[model samples]
Target: MLASPRPIPSQRLSRLWYLGRATGDLAAGLGFKGLIELAQSQAQDRPARIQISPEHARRFAERLSELRGAVMKLGQLMSMDGTDILTPEVAEVLAGLRERATPMPMSQLVEVLTREYGRDWDRRFKRFEFTPVAAASIGQVHRAETHDGHRLALKIQFPGVRASIDSDIANLGLIVRTLGLGPKGIDIRPFLDEARRQLHREADYEAEAKALERYRACLGDDPDLAVPQVHRDLTTPNILAMDLATGVPIDRLAGPEYRRAERDRAATLLMRLTLRELFEFGLVQTDPNFANYLYDRTSGRIVLLDFGAMVPIAPSLITCYRQLARAIIAGDRAGIQAAAIALGYVGAADPQDQVAAMLDLLELAAEPLRSPGVYDFGASDLFERVYRQGRALFHAGVFSAAPAPETMFLHRKFMGSFMLARRLRARVELAQLVPLCL
Candidate 1:
């Protein structure tokens, strides 16, 4: 069933109003004791580490979700990256941002279509579904068929999403800072800047259409992968039209109905695709949300979706990664440290012990790559070990220096793949795949 339509707060003032209301709700939900704790923290002049109740978190998430733009997008990013820092209750609530978003009302949807395709836009289609098949931060996608009998998915942008990106990001940053909701002493400005840049690119459907075509070309004749073809006639800056690819969500492969072999194969293909995007195609779809992938069981292919978050990889960056990969595979500590320094994973001026700790964490992460044969993701506690080590480093002030934005985005994709593999309990042949990428 489609979510009940909610009009997006498109103007800066309107979005700010919703944010203020959400903040108000949070404060009220805290109760007297919580307010006292906040006052105490302020008196001491230390960072407020108030634990949000589940209900308060849910209310906050609902408000952001309703905005359906950069605010929601940033919330989704935080949900994924803030697991270590955010309380479990808050993280769990924010995770809902990844699911289907509340779609725009039909009247508003029609208005956008009319603006892009004229008042007689209905003449262009034999049938257009009023309900969205998928709703996301920037847009909602509807299944439609043209008079010529071509089936297409139309991604209609939320009105004013492009114009409101800057304000939405600024408002979100202010709220996070004021509430002391982010990590203490960490400079999140760089990440917020990256989010703003990415949001702008994503809001441009024209660019995404071009990115879709380019990515499809890069994957030409790949029997295991499928990318939808762009439908140029119906595409516009606010509307992206493409062939309607069919499949079940990729995460379904983790179910018992799927054979162990199938699970392994699916995960292996994804890992190989990630490597190819970095080392060969030089274009990576940086958003690793599982919804972006689908499994076509009938054809035994992985169908790719959503090209808005695609990023170009510099050759130099690829070279650094290749060096890092080879060093990890060979268990060469000196080579690994050198590559790490070059990649900005660790700074030259960082304390020796901190640098060594970072290197150890990197080595632990490369365990799968160094495995002689298939590495069983399900059997490994690698993620937990890495998380604990990372938390330790964070407390020791080792993560003060943020990696380059490109590196941060690329790692998000890598970690997404890793988490998915672990979820499916897949045994990937990283031993073979790592060499091919190098």
Candidate 2:
């Protein structure tokens, strides 16, 4: 069902413009580099010059959180990948910003509802919770039961989010570049362009509905998981209605009460899903926010939410990934490097020194996947090794930042889930799922 077009309001537009400008100003000031310098200065107090990164990163994150929107979305991404780049405190700030969406007041919500249900939306729902059940970058989700007695989750897009996307990305790119996070001196124009395209697609709920149906068909058979079903009729570009799969967040792995064995099972299911999404189905919901996965312990199912960032991979891309996976399983070092070079990850122009760094990273990444006993997330040394090599590569201008915009968001999602699994001390057999892809 097509949603009636909802026009943008003047007031919302002005608010977005104001937010965008504030973010741009901050980007120009304490950008990524500024954050690093601030952190570095704090490091001087220590004998080993150990960075007090978490504290400084938190300060910067506080600013990004206040700005919200696409910038907040970016902060969430940074927070998820904290193992490599950010200290825990800095990551906390980013993580704090993750689910912290600015609420769309009842007035704005009504304007959105009026467009979708023909001004009689309040009448359609027996009751609508004014307080949002979940809040994300461009939307806030509410809980409601329809007059027909169906329980549904309602996701309403924040007012004027679509219009400000371009400005948001442009401003965000400026901040990240000034922070020197990407390939130094590389033209990141392509990545920014891809981000804008994806964000616009995310603003559309119709596409998400279609994608959700397809995923249901794909993973509906997984006894250990649940993908929320889309309510097509109730759905608008802005409003996404679905049956809510209630559960404790996977992040509860961090709590003391969760059993060790239970945590391992949760981690296994998550790993299996990623392998299935990338290799078997060639379709994936790429965003890796910890908020996206929920643990319904009673049912032993992982609830997957959000499909706007989904990507369908080409056969060759899947082939490249599988080849890389195969190389790891076989423990073929030369084969791994060949595949990395073919995948355009290890550049031909990179001297032997840089090539060694790439090899070290590849070897570290393949470790837990290849080990016979268990992959230890708690003891994982890969993050530090990669972080060190990543910094060196950036300084050497050896690596050109590559966003398989397809795999880009997927990586974030996978990494975050894995971190959660690690915190739980989950011992999962990597080969079990990888073999399915094979």
Candidate 3:
């Protein structure tokens, strides 16, 4: 069910005001809760630990969702970055941003259509649904049918999202710095810059349409994968029109209705596609949000959506990752170290202890690849182990040397695939898949 349509706070002042209010509300809520918990703890002679309750998280998420742009995108990114660096409570709060966003009011939606199609937008479509089929940080997607009887999905960019990208990021940066929301000692500027750049590209429907067409062509009639076709005539700078590809949400396959083999095959296809994106096609859709993928039960094909975050992979980077993978598989520490240096995971000037720690972390991450066969994602403790190691590294300031922005983006996709596999409890022959990529 959709939340009631509320006007998006687009202006800098408006957005800033909302942020300030949300922050105040959160602080007050936490303060009051902490006092109550502290009283109880003192009475019981136990130490008090203040935590962000579910109520507080819901309130924070509601404000961010209403804003629906960089603020919400930042929250989504934090959630995807996982719990290694964040308190579990904070992670839970940001996780809500990944769900549906509050849609623009019908009037606001019509205003955009009028501006784009010039008042007679209704003439072009046989039928247009006012309610969005999907909504996200940058835009909402509506279901519509063309006069020629072609069903289409129209992605409408929010008003002022493109114009406010820089200011939005700048303001969010200020808030993050003031609140110390970032990991201590680590410079998040590179990540912020990369996000700003990606948001700009995402806001441009024209660029997204081109990316969608190119990515679809790259897939080239693969039986197990599907990409929507762009409807060029219906596309605009802010509105993207494409063939409506339908399926159950990709995560739904984790349910009892899906057989173990079906889940395994689906996850395998995603893992293989990730490799192909880097090593073969030289293009990667960096957004790892599960919403971007869908599974057609009847066709048994994965439907890919949202090409806005698609990035071109440099051949050199591809070679570097290939080396990294082979090195991991071969259990060659020296090879892994070399590849890590090449990939900027660690610097030569860094302390030897930090470097060695990073290597340990990398080796742990590659455990699935080292497994003999059919590593069970559902039963694995890799994420927990990784979190513990990562937290240690973070406290030791190992992440202060941020990787190249491109590497960060690619890492997100890789982690996203891993998380999806875990969610489906799919067993994958990662050892076999590594060879094909190599």
Candidate 4:
């Protein structure tokens, strides 16, 4: 993820204060009995129990949402990036925090616009739609039309979002600790911190404008893809202005109108882009949220959006994964094991235990590359079987803790994209594409 801009010392302290306030509530409720019950419930066949009440969960979600700074950012990460760590109830509750952000008032909106486009900015736009077309945690987007006849999408960050970031992060750490998410279990802190950094980078419209141009140039001459043009003169640190591209969400391939071959081709293009992004480009869009992709049915191309979360992969790590892929295809289990260990995936104690897990995980990903015809992602029991095996490991103390935060994000992005392809019933020549990297 792109590095976040540094904050002032006062801002950092404020963030810690907010974190303390949130955790203070949890500490008061979490008595020794609560802790014991949490342990007993966790020891059972299911996941760790939430000894806390539904009412408290709602309250917790609300505070995080209202804070809507780093705290909400971390909560949203758990919703998407750490879904496995949470039970269904907790996941559902936490996911709401992603969408529960209170909107910034129109007055705040005008203030932001004035700062970006100047006092005469209203005159440049023939019409400004104050009502947002969509809302996410960090900001809301509005459809606007300029006198120059360009329909643009304006992304306006919520008031104080930048200012509150540090405090929110500090508060998030305190809450996670108070709730007992540490190295012994799944350490979600890295994921949370990384997400916050991206969100902060995203808050900078100027950076996104630059990243958008870089992506467009990077993917130049590709007929099957599209990236929107940025209006640099009008862009600002918080307000991103770009041409409003028209296309349906990529998942539209789920429709019956999509031919199997077309579905497969679409999936192929996406997977190929992913491979190139990592192996060749050394740059990746770390956030693979479904909303980022759009389908142009008439042209048979995919429209890519949101460059703020674009990240650079280290050449060494990319080489490591590329080697691992070559080993997997060559059926070198020992090589794969060694790669896994080098990647901090396996500890010396019961090392094979983790290798077995990696094998099972890779099998799910590699199945399509080995098999022909439209892959039936719907029919696969990978999720259930993996869940069962994972639960067993947790019980036996054979399974180690979570993968590195970076790996976890990469897995989510891959799984998310793979699921999209599977939804399309895409028949990609994944195996054929692997050798291209080597």
Candidate 5:
């Protein structure tokens, strides 16, 4: 058995640790900046390929993975949106968090299982594996079997993760502010506060179990989808137990061996699910890590996993988004801006030029929907164009407010699905899906 992790730092102590790490990063960044300036002065006409040392980024990621709560979740969020804003080295390193996170040692796993069940917990299972099958920012999952021949997946929360949420959130805010990862004018406090709230919800396994049951109820009849059945007897606030569903990670289908038509069908199914989550169910699983989806080839079903990040949609916001979708389909920029203002994306007092720029960016994002037929995500330049324009707008100090909590997660879920569609080179007729949802 491996040694357990050193206990995560508490509220007061973690703040100091985060500060120290931030200071180190600041020094490294300044050093890199100075080197760039010196190189520019020496080579007046030549362009330079600028990158930070890989070690700086690696160390940063390692520290957050070790902490494993709000800090790691924040890293996951940054990695999701970091391509345009972060240096290549930093972005590459943070991207690792999206993969299976570091798992707890066998010893720590024993302690948690013992705490949740009794020290004689082995009696409850016919067989239980000490090694984890998957791990993430909040927990690690292991395989188990009951005496009645039921196989199960047990998601065990890290011992201290829930306790450390508030501190990790505060520490992350300090680190981001000190490093200035976003535009200077943007106030990310609302985002940070929302992250804190969501973290609390995610850390609660009991709540996640209820969400799983709710989703099963709503989506159970769908022939192309699968949701695991929760094992309530084995479940607790710190541990979630569900029937083990066999499947390959959805990303595996992105390879050349899969037929283009099959890939397109998969993407379309996911898009339809997103529409249902928004307009029909009003509930969404916001974390977009591709690993959360699995392809059960035998059944041709998309297996949904991990409901910890599920969130309910606001009804009013859905109406606003419906209007925005209609405006995008009609190519009405003014209508788009009006809907955006309704959704709190802009203000009445903003200058017309600034609002127009924002509307243009929104329209660009809607490129896939504007097409009357299939949208070729693989060949599209919309993502790149949007990044370039959004960055330019940010540099111009056009954006001030952080997105509302509902909008932020909704955007994450939708954008994440789009990125996956592109990865699979999946073509979809998104315009048709939009109306069905409305």
Candidate 6:
């Protein structure tokens, strides 16, 4: 079994030590220059295979978990953005950051409880589990029962994570640049700054509680979805309490026993919700981690969790995105180009062939929306096609500007949702669903 991460390093120097250790460990593996050369010479039919040793993966994960703030979040970001660039072995190791990290020891938990709820905090709960049920970068959640016998989940923020956010992010940026993990010619500074801002909001439990409530209201009367109700009396800036919502993890449906209809229903509901979030609610929980979604088999509803990454979308951007989709459906290249430029996806100076390739990639991705009915994700080769185009574009050095954080995050959510659908081999009437959003 993988070892649970040790205590988080709250002090600046302590955190810096953990990062330095991780960078050194990664450096011991295949160097970044080696990776860049391998990628260049890699064959299209059979890509060169290189893997980080298991020891390095474990070591990297451990240090990130120990740091448990912006550093850990950076690991998750690398896992997501490095899919095409990083070797699979390395990506697999980084992907583990998405799951629970080691929980804070009982002493630490008690200290937080005492700080938040006072000396008589034990009296408030009929029973509380000392061990956390789930742990993440900013906090870990415990299961508890109120004196009134109400079952609840308590989210306790790691001490000092909020204060350490800025420094941790700065340290993380330094480590990334030093390792040359970033792709050539792409300025990652805006995205890094955006991440710091987002992490600050996530560390604020009070803000998360409000976003949860707003999201619940936004998803009102949606029979297919469920959001936990916040217990305001028990909530504080560092703590959040809500009903103990129960369900199986959504990924369980990946099993062979799950029928096509059941899988399709889940995917369609998720896609529909995504559209509503973008076009109707104008707000979204941008992190689409499978663990954040639970399937209530009895209720047939998807239980939504983790409101920390929730963000608002600009109305004009949504308009541009919708226009882009409409143009794809209509085969209007000019309209597509106009919308792409408006959305900051293509630069005005990008070469015509490169722009054409980008447009082709966009059109391929939009195929589901353009289909009349039952777009089969199981049989689709769209991902491979898009990957090929994206690889070529990345090497051509024609794309310079990174999309705004808002657009990038929205795309992240969309792509993740689609990936889940593909994993379940879902068949969705996506064309029909697009109309509901408009």
Q: Which scores greater on lDDT, model 5 or model 6? A: 6
Instruction: Give candidate 3's error at residue 269 in angstroms.
Output: 1.3
Full candidate order by TM-score, most accurate first: 3, 6, 1, 5, 2, 4
The local distance difference test score of model 1 is 0.85
Off by over 4 Å in 2: 1-67, 81-90, 178-181, 347-357, 400-405
TM-score against native, each model = 0.88, 0.85, 0.90, 0.76, 0.88, 0.90
Model 5 accuracy (lDDT, Cα): 0.79
Summarize candidate 2's per-residue lDDT along 1-438 as a digit string, tens digits: 111223332244454455455454544545566666656743432111223355455555554544445666777776665644444555555676566555656777888889878866788789888887766777878899988988999988887778778877776676567756555566778778878888888888888888888988988677888888888888988898999779876767667887877788888878888888888777888777777888887777889888888888888877877888888888877777777776777876668777777767777766667787677776676655555655655556566545355555556656665666665667788866678768
Every candidate's lDDT:
0.85, 0.70, 0.85, 0.68, 0.79, 0.81
The C-alpha stretches of model 4 lying farther than 4 A from their native spots are 1-102, 181-192, 252-265, 347-366, 369-373, 394-405, 422-429
Between candidates 4 and 6, the TM-score winner: 6
Candidate 5 lDDT by residue in tens digits, 1-438: 222344545565864576467447635753767567545733442223335556776666666676677667766776664544457677767777765566777678889989999989999999999877777789988999999999999999988889888877776677678756545776788887887888899999999999999988988688899899999999999999999988877767877878888889999999999989888887899988777889988888989998998998888888888899988888887789889889877787888888888888888888888788999887887776776688677766678755576578888899988887886788999989888887
Please give, for residues 283-355, the per-residue lDDT of candidate 4 as tens digits. 7876655557878888888888888877777777887788778777887777777676666666545556556
RMSD of each: 4.1, 5.3, 4.2, 6.1, 4.0, 3.0
Candidate 6 has its poorest 10 consecutive residues by lDDT at: 41-50
List the candidate 3 regions with Cα displacement exceeding 4 Å. 24-52, 78-96
| Residue-level lDDT tens digits of model 3 in 159-178 | 98888888888888898899
Cα displacement (Å) at residue 352, model 4? 5.1
Candidate 3 lowest-lDDT run of ten: 41-50
Query: Could you tell me the TM-score of candidate 2?
Result: 0.85
Candidate 3 lDDT at 265 equals 97
- Candidate 1 vs candidate 6: which has greater TM-score? 6
Error of 3 at 316 (Å): 1.4
Estimate the TM-score for candidate 5. Answer: 0.88
